[model samples]
Each structure stands twice: as C-alpha cells, then as structure tokens.
Target chain A: MYEGVVQDLIDELGRLPGIGPKSAQRIAFHLLAADSTDVRRLAAVLVEVKDKVRFCRTCGNVAEGEQCRICSDTRRDLSKICVVEEPKDVVAIEKTREFRGRYHVLGGAISPIEGIGPDDLRVRELMTRLADGEVTELILATDPNLEGEATATYLARLVKPMGLRVTRLASGLPVGGDLEYADEVTLGRAFEGRRLLDV
Target chain B: MSLYRDEGVVLRTQKLGEADRIITLLTRANGRVRAVAKGVRRTKSKFGARLEPFTHADLQIYAGRSLDVVQQVETIASHGDAIAGDYGRYTAGTAMLETAERLTAEEKEPAVQQFLLLVGGLRTLAEGSHPPGLVLDSFLLRSLAVGGYAASFDDCARCGRVGPHPFFSVPAGGVVCASCRSAGAVTPAPETLGLLAALLTGDWAVADASDARHRREASGLTSAYLQWHLERGLRSLRLVERT
Candidate 1:
C-alpha cells in the first residue's frame, strides 16, 4: 500500500516488542537508505538467529548446537542444577561466578492473565531430565516477578513430590539504599529472608 | 446464561465482612475484572483456595450489582502453596502480583501486551528457572515498556541522540546526558545504564552477563523509574532483593 518491500519491513518491525509504528517506519527508511551490503548483513544476522540459535537439547538454553556450553561442559557440577527462565538467565548467573553448576532454562514464566500455564514451558523436559536421579537439588532462579514466583512454586510442588530438594533465591533490601529509602515490601522481605551471621 | 466459565489469576483479594471477599483478577479473555467470592472464608468452602491470590482458576461468576459473584471454581494452578512456603519466591511473587495489579488498572483495559507479560512473567517465576530478582526486573522493565514508560538507555530519553550516557532521571523519562541531568537526578554508572537497557529490552544476554554490582545499580534505577510511574511505589517491590 505504501511502497515496495519497505512497507513489509515496517509492518514486521512494528510487530517487535519495543519498536513502535514510528520507529518501524524510521528503521525501514533507514534500511532502505543504507548500503545494500549492510542491509544484506542485517538480513543474514536475522536468518542466522533462526538457523544457528536453537534451544539446548538437555537444558533448553539457546545454543548453536545440540547442547548449551554449560550443559556440555565437563567441569560444572551436574548434580546441582540452577533452574532459570531463559538462556539469558544463564549469562546472569555465570556473571556471578559464585555458582559452578549446570542450568535448566524454562523458556518462560507463568502468568494466567496472558493464558500461559505450566504446560506452556519446557517443564516436562525438566521432569524428564530429573528422572535420571543424578541431580540432588534444584535451585529455582526465575525472576522475582509474579510470573517467576508462580513458576517457581509450580516447579517446587512438582519437583518436591518427586522427593527432590527445591530452593529459591533469597530476596532482601538492595545495597545502595538506606533503611529510610527502602519500601515496606523490600523491608519486609529483608527482615523475612535475613541471613544468619557466623560471628 | 452469560457464558459463565472463564480463566483468571487472582491478583488481589480483600476481606469483605466475615464470609465473603472482593477479588481483583486479570482474565484470559475479558481482561481485568473485579468480583466477589461468597463464603470463601468459611472452612467448608469448596473453592476457597482457587480464589486466593496467585492462584489460577477456571471460574464461573454470576453477575452482581457492584461486582460478579464467584459461583463455581476449579483450580488451574495452585501456586500459592509452594510460593507461600518459600520466603524468597513468596515476596517476589507478591511484588509481581502488585505490579500486575497496578498496570492492569481500569476494568477491561484491553492490555493484551500487559496481560501477556504478567502471564509469561508468572510462569517463569513459578518454574523456578531464574533468580527471583532477575525475574522481577525483567517483569518490571517489560511492564514499564507495556505501560508506555519505557526507559531509554543507548539513546537520549528526550532528544533521540544515541549514546552510552549514564545519567538517569525517571521524571525525564530515561537515561540522560551530563548536560541533561534534570534537577534531583542521580547519575547512574555507564554499566548500570547498559544493564538497564538490557533489562528494558529483554537482552538477557547483556543482563545475565552483567556483574552483580551493575545489576544492582540497574535494579535501583529500575525501581526508581517504576516508583515514579506508579506514583505511590509498588507495595511489593520493596520485598524483592536486588542482589
């Protein structure tokens, strides 16, 4: 209706999460005005994302091959599995360097408002992985959001019934703020999840 | 018959008299709704657990004068039990619930994006896949984006100039320049800004790759931005641990 392939690009880009109609048009026009080589490069990258990036066979993380690096690695502790929502969360945990365990990505969290249920994620795969009896504990690392919490609870119930230990990451007050600055909820969490000092 | 069956997550429930309660829910098809659960507080009630907060239910609610009355209910996911047992998951879940409640204001607000975000967020949380803090941040960033208050990171929040500036002024929208720091603004570190950008955009590669300090810094910015937009601060966010 508007132009050639430019119209299609705008429509597709507009479908992205943050890109709006205005941004879509701007990006489409930019692509049209850019060098053909760069445009082709962008297209290649997009194609590669689908072709090259796939879920890890064992853990469900985005990987270039059959298994994600963490799942395939020999050094990490397979007995300790850190359960997280997406492949991206693996990166977050890796950055901490405090954990040396393998991971299981759930792909997404649960929110009934959006019609997402426990059955929608890679949860069944997790149950399958746990059946081997190699893993001793499951550290639920889903985000501290409602969906993440719901996901953790759902998993704990399912996993615990199988006689596996399920744990959640602790919540508390942040570092850069005084007690005066913290909200009632954070304060409550900090008080509830208080860590014991070994003094 | 008004087609009574619908699926919804109980966002919040307020005690009403002794045996009844008011429930706020976000439905799969009808969007946000407020309803009453009669005698839900009684010990012998059939579906009390199904109507509790954080519980997903397939419900039939008869229309009432002020609110709909829950007639029959089936538990879709009894998440509250597992969540309530763990302090961390419980707090994080509460924060998400409150945030969802705040975002889905205005009955039938046609917030398809928000509805999806909450559902997806809750699922991730329930599965115990990521750290609750990370999940909360993801939800907050996405929620803000859905609410039209998305924070800018690589670009100026006001001017559209692409940058890696670290200044964050929630009232000014997002990241700012040295020159654009609004009055009473805090200049977040460049790393913090980058982390925030990743969170805002769901670039978990960037976010998960960030250092703990940077994630915490970004989280502070996120909370401030969320509080600014929500006006009265998210009652549950305080319970979430940033680290």
Candidate 2:
C-alpha cells in the first residue's frame, strides 16, 4: 500500500464500477501529478453533476428538471414509446437518428442475481404512462441480454391485456460479421426472421 | 512468462477500467480462473464480443503475477444471445453459471466433471428441449454430486435403509428413514421424491412426465438441498420463473 492519502484516493477510485486496483492506483497517481486546476475542475464537475442531475419523473431518464428533453419535446411522436434499460441506451438509439418517438428508460433490467426485479425498475411509472391509452406501439429496446430479456418478457405479459402493440427489437447477426463464426442460435434466428425484399 | 491454451466457459465478467474487463472462466483444464481481458470494452476490440457470459471460447492466456491475462480468444459457442432471448432459460442458465463458479471455489485446479456438466447444461438450456426449471434442477443436482455433496434419494442418507424413504431432509443429505429423519425433515409426496431421484440420475423421461405439483415440490427440495450444501442461496435461482 502507498502512504495514507494516496492509499485513500486509490481505494476511492477502485470503488468506482469499472476501476480496479491497478487502474485505481494509476489514476490516483495521475491525479496527484496533474495540475491542481485540472483536478479541481474534475472535482467540481463531479459534485455539480450529483447536485443537478435527476431522473425524469415521466420516463426515468437522466434529467436536470422534472422531465427529460425527450419527454418535453413537442415534436417527438407520443403515439409510440421506445423502452430501454438505461439512459446510455437512449444515447445509443439517438445516435442512430432513426427513431422519432418518445423514450421510456427503465433504469435497469430485471436481474434476480443482483436482487433487481421489475419492482426495482421504473415499470410502475411506465404502466402509469400507458394507462392513458395514447401510445399505440410499445417497442421493447432493452439490451439483448438475459436480464434485459427477462424484464421485457415480464413487461410484455403485464401489458398484454392493455391492447397495445408490444414488440421486441429483432436480434441477429451483426453487420460485417462472418456467417461461419455466427453461433447456431443466432444463425437460426436470422433464418427464421428472414424478411422479403421490398424492391 | 508461461502461455497456455484452454477451452472455457465465461462464467462472469466485471468491468475493470475505461476499456477492459475482468473475466471469470471455468475451463476444462484450468478449473475456475480469473483473468484480465485488456481493452475488451472497446468497440474495435477483436475478441470483445466473444468473451461475454455464457460463451464457450478457446483462449490463450499469459500467466501474470496477480492475475492471468487473456491474450487471444476465439468463440466456440456463443450461448449469450440464445440464453438472453428467453426469460425462463436465461434465469436457469444464470443459476448454472453461478453454481459452477461456487462449486469450483478455487483457481487453476482441474475440474473436468464440472466443466463438462456446465457445457452440457448450457447446451441443453439453449436447445429448449425440456422445461428450463427441470433442466436447472438437474444441472444443480449433478453439479452438487460432482462437488462430492451428492444427495441420496433412493436409499436413506443417514442409515442404510433399503426401500424409498418418505422423509426428505437437507441437513441429513437426502431422503431419510423415519428413525434417522432430522427435526426439520419434510415428508414430500412419493412422486416428488421420485422426481428428485430422476433429476439426480438424468432420467429425463420420468422428470418430464411428472405432474406440476410434484415438480414444484421437487424444485423446492432441490433448492433447499443446494443451499444447505453451498451454505448460501444462489441469487439467480430466486428470479427463475418456474413453469
């Protein structure tokens, strides 16, 4: 271990989600050697973010006010809602520039191993939003992972009686991927979900 | 700087830094090993997608002082997408992976039986042949057996009694005679006991044909038995939507 303050800094950095011990140590040292003004700016930003950012009351996406920019936008389509697991996923979908509908951030997927279930997410809020019957199409854009799938399935069953058109994102081979390297399950899905040419 | 190659299943993964991950793998030869996959979080990384959980991969690892480093990885079977697409199967598969990690409980020790069982369990789960719950129970029972905690269902676990015992006790190993039954022993239905036995012995026909009540009872007993042996409940098991 290093001296008192250095060790403390390293430990704190290590506690972050993706920062391990070695990386923590490297970052701590980099900070110590960095200009004081830069470190101060980073510290200020961290505190500022914590003080300002909050979840949108309507959709659970990160926000500075009661609602996120997407929820407040008048131009976006309110008839369709794209549900995702996290705010980062909203950014990812936004990068595509293809979706013009509103978004509902679930905050996280249903992961029993982590003691996270539908109750722990923003499902109730989503149900509240759907109660109005304004949304005609509900697209489940949760990650194509086990937890995400579980969450999607649970939501699908819960909302089945509501008469909304519920759908999940189609998953298959990634672009530029080799067919020979594709797993049997994914390859099979691609074949089963094959679509006809529109030309 | 010794380098070696082995086929392994990605049991779990945790982010390490800006663009790296710490992967826990259960390998055919090296048992359960923790290794650092540098820059695996980067979009341009060659083997990033191949090292996800539930994936069976061929890996070349360079042994490091604190942790081994994964140098190269090639996908053998990517079960992640398949397992993730279904809820029941996903939860079952997660429990299986957690069980494998818990059973091995050591690094670099050869556990060929555990490895094979995990591979088989995942393959069966992905195939969606039988109920995911039944498959999970079977995998858990077999894994416990491989870990030297095999529960006795046909005969008494404590005393050497012959015929099928009526009492099932987690603390006493498995089925127990009336005289050898523990304080908290439960008298499950005869069918439930039969279902448990079928699961432990890979009798899928008997297991598949069993009624829902018996299956639920068997599942409860199997989970209790597993927790008793592991000294803790598996987190993934609680989330499984039993069919």
Candidate 3:
C-alpha cells in the first residue's frame, strides 16, 4: 500500500467496474506525475457530471435534464422504439445513421448468473411508453449473447398481446468479413436469415 | 510457451482489459480451465460466437504464468443458438453451465464424467426432445452423482434397510427408512421417486411418460437435494421454467 491520500485514490479507482488493482495503481501514479491544472479540470468535470447528468424520464439514457437529446428531438420518428442494453449502445446505433427512431436503455440484460432478472431492468418504463399506442414497432437491439437473448425473449412475450410488431436484430456474419472465418452459430444464422434475390 | 489441445464446453466468460475476455471452460481432459481470448469482443473476431455458453469446441491453449491464453478454437457443436432461441431452454442451459462450474471445485483436475454429462445434457437440451425441466433435472442428478453426492431413490439413505421408504430428506442424502426418519423429512409421492430414478438412470421412456404434476414435484426435490449438497442454492436454477 502507498501513503495516505494516494492509497485512498487507488482504492476508489479500484472500485470502478473493469478497473483492477494493477490498473488503479498505474492510473494513480500517472495522475501524480501530471500537471495540477489537468488534474483539477478532471476533478471538476467529474463533480459536474455527477451534479448535472441524470437518466432521461422517457428512456433510461443518460441526460442533463428531463430527457436525453434523442428523446427531446421533434424530428425523430415517433412510431418506432429501439431498445438497447446501455447508454453506450445508443451511441453505437446512432453512429450507424440507419436508425432514426428513439431508444430505451434497459440499463442491463437479464443475467441469472449475476442474479439479474427482468425486474432489475427498465421494462416497466418501456411498457408505459408503448401503452399510449404511439409505437407501431418495437425493435430489440440487445446483444446476441445468452443473457441478452433471454431478455429479448421475455420482452417479446410480454408485449405480444399488445399487437405491436416486435422484431429482433438479425444475427449473421459481420460486415467486411470472410465467410470461412465466421463461427458456426453465425454462419447458421446467416443462412436462416438469408434474403431472396430480386431480379 | 507450452501448448496443449482439448475439447471442452464454454461455461461462461467475463470481459478483460479493453477487448479481451476470460473464458471458463469445462474440458474433457483438463477439467475446468480459465483462459484469455485476446480481442474476442471485437466485431471481426474469428471465433467469438463459438466461445459462448453451451458451445462445445476444440481449443488449443498456451500455458501462461497465472492464466492460459487461447490460441485456436474450432466449433464441435454450436448448441448455444438452438438453446438460446427459446426462453425455457436457455435458462435451463445456463443453470447447467453454472452447476458444472460449481461442481468442479478445483482447476486443472480431470473430470471426464462431469464433462461428458454436460455435453450430453446440452445436446439433449438443444434437440428439444423432452421438456427442458426434465433435461435440467436429469443433468443435475447425474452431475451430483459424479461429484460424489449421489442421492438414493430406493433403499435407505441413512440405514441399511430395504423396500421403498416414505420419508425423503435432502440432508440425510435421499429417501429415509421409517426407523431413520427425522425432523424436516418430506413424504413425497411414490411417483416422484420413480421419476427421479428414471432421470438418474436415463430411463427416458419412463420419464417422458410421467405426468406433469409428478414432474414438477420431482423437480422441486431434485433442486432441493442439489442445493443441500452444494451448501448453497444455484442462482440460475430459480430462473429455470419448471413447467
């Protein structure tokens, strides 16, 4: 252990997800050698983010006020709602420029190994958004892994009686990839979801 | 670096560093092994989906200081897609994976029986031939037996008495005789015991012909017995759809 406040900093940094003890120690040393002004700016930004950023009321995406930028936008298509697992997912989908609808961040997926279930996510909020009959399509963009698929299945069953067009993102080979390199599961899904050629 | 080859099932994975993942596998020869797969989370990863839960794969691993590094992977059976397509089967498969990891308490220890049981269980689950609940129960019973915590459906678990006993106790190992019956013992139906026996011995005809009520009762007893021996209940077991 290091002396006094330096040790305290390392402990706090170590508590963050994916930041282990070794990385925490390295980051602490790097901060110590940096300029005081840069450190102060980082500290100020951290405090300001905590004070200002809050989850959107409609969706669970991170926001500065009542709603996120996407939720507040008037030009976005109101008939579609794409559900995702995290705020980072919203950024990823946004970069594609293919989807112009709003999003619902579920906060996380249903991972039984981690003791997480549907109740732990923002399912109830998404249902409320759909209750108004504004959304004609509900797109599930959750990850293709086990926990994510379970969450999507749960949501699909829950909303089946509501008469909405529920759809999940297709699983297949990645773009700009060779077919021989794809895994069996991916290859199988690609064949299952194959499209017919239109002359 | 010394390298070795093995065939195994991917039990689970956790993120490491920026793009790598620490994959835990239950192998036919090496038992439970944890290895790092570099850049596996990236989109262009060659075998990312093949390392998912319930997937059977042939792997080449390089021995590391603390954790081994995965060098090559070939899919032997991609049961994940078939199992994950349905909610009931997915939850059952997850519980099986969790139990496999839980039963093998040591790393690098050979557990060939446990590995074979898991592979067969996953295959049965993916095939959707029987109810997922039944498949999970059978897997749990067999896995417990391999782990040296086998439950007795006939004869006395506590005493040397014979004949079918009435009282069943989880802590006492299984069905107890009248002379050995103690507090907290439950008197399950005769059919529940028969169903459990059929499950353990792979008597699929008897198991498939059993009634739904008996299946539910057998599942409760099986999970209780499994948790009792494990000393802690499996978190994923509760999420499995028993019906």
The local distance difference test score of each candidate is: 0.77, 0.88, 0.92
Which tens-of-lDDT digit does each residue in A64-183 have in candidate 2? Answer: 998999999999999999999989999999999999999999988887666676778899999999999899999999876456666788789889899999999886777886777665
User: lDDT of model 1 at residue B61?
Assistant: 78
Q: Which stretches of candidate 2 lie over 4 Å from their true place?
A: A1-45, A170-199
lDDT of 3 by residue, B35-121 (tens): 999988887898788788888999999989899999999999888767877888988888999999999999999999999999999
Q: Please give the ranking of all candidate structures by lDDT, highest first, separated by commas.
A: 3, 2, 1
Two-chain DockQ for each candidate model: 0.01, 0.42, 0.70
What's the candidate order when arranged by decreasing DockQ?
3, 2, 1
Residue-by-residue lDDT tens digits, candidate 1, B146-213: 88888777777877777777677789888777777788778777777777777777777777777888
True contacts kept of 2: 0.46
Candidate topping TM-score: 3
Q: How many clashes in each candidate?
A: 41, 0, 0
Residue-wise C-alpha lDDT for candidate 2, range B75-186, written one tens digit per residue: 8988876777687788888889999999998799999999999999999899888899999999999999999999999889998798588998899899889889889999
Once fitted onto the true fold, the runs of candidate 1 whose alpha carbons sit more than 4 angstroms away are: A1-199, B1-3
User: How displaced is residue A111 in candidate 3, in Å?
Assistant: 1.5
TM-score of each: 0.54, 0.87, 0.96
Clashing pairs in 2: none
